[model samples]
Target: MSEQHTYRVIVRGVWDGLSEDSRARLLAEVDDHGLTAMTFSEEGSLTYDRALKHFSWRFTVVSDAADGDEMAAAIAEDRAASALAALGHGFRDLRSTVTDLDTMKINYKGGRR
Candidate 1:
């Protein structure tokens, strides 16, 4: 059985400035990738560090990823980046954990891009 991947995405940009249509387009792109969009609060002052619009997403996806089959990972990463770029937003970090079907264990991993 293949593993399931849960991706935590932090997208930062000017969300308040975007037009309604732009917002819809952005969510639509997210939906296209089978990811149901979620919301994120400002969490601090308007002038908080860097002061960019931010949203957090959580979605689970499964791919036929073998030990070294990078195509699945690469495709998933590209699709996510494209979804963000379509709305003129910046793609930050994507933290994911792989759950082995047999072992049923969750491990946290990291990578910055």
Candidate 2:
């Protein structure tokens, strides 16, 4: 079995509403939470200007499935969820949709699940 996993986390909100300092604090908190990798995607300015402006942040946590048990995936997911929640950013648990060997992908959004 392969030994790789991926997870996605979506954060929706006015990215611009957050001050630069707050942004930095959020990023630092994420890092402190120990996520393997994280990426952010922002809609175009026009969309950002819309009433429902929002942004998405994805987190990918890599682990070795072949060397570990299913618990690893659960732990990763729990940790990610806790981390985001700790940052005061809404964190919705989207459970793992894909559970391939060495790969587990979980999705999370800030708003309602």
* The best candidate in terms of TM-score: 1
Model 1: CA > 4 A from native: 1-54, 68-73, 105-113
TM-score of each candidate? 0.35, 0.30
lDDT of each: 0.40, 0.41
Separately for all candidates shown, the number of backbone clashes (residues 3 or more apart, or on different chains) is 0, 1
lDDT of 2 at 9: 30
In candidate 2, the residue pairs with backbone N, CA or C atoms under 3 Å apart (3 or more residues apart, or in different chains) clash, namely: 4-102
Q: Which residue pairs overlap in candidate 1's backbone?
A: none
Q: Cα lDDT for residue 18, model 1?
A: 54
Which lDDT tens digits does candidate 1 get at residues 1-113? Answer: 76544322232223445566655655655443232224222221111122234543332334544542244334445555565566565446543333333445677788767
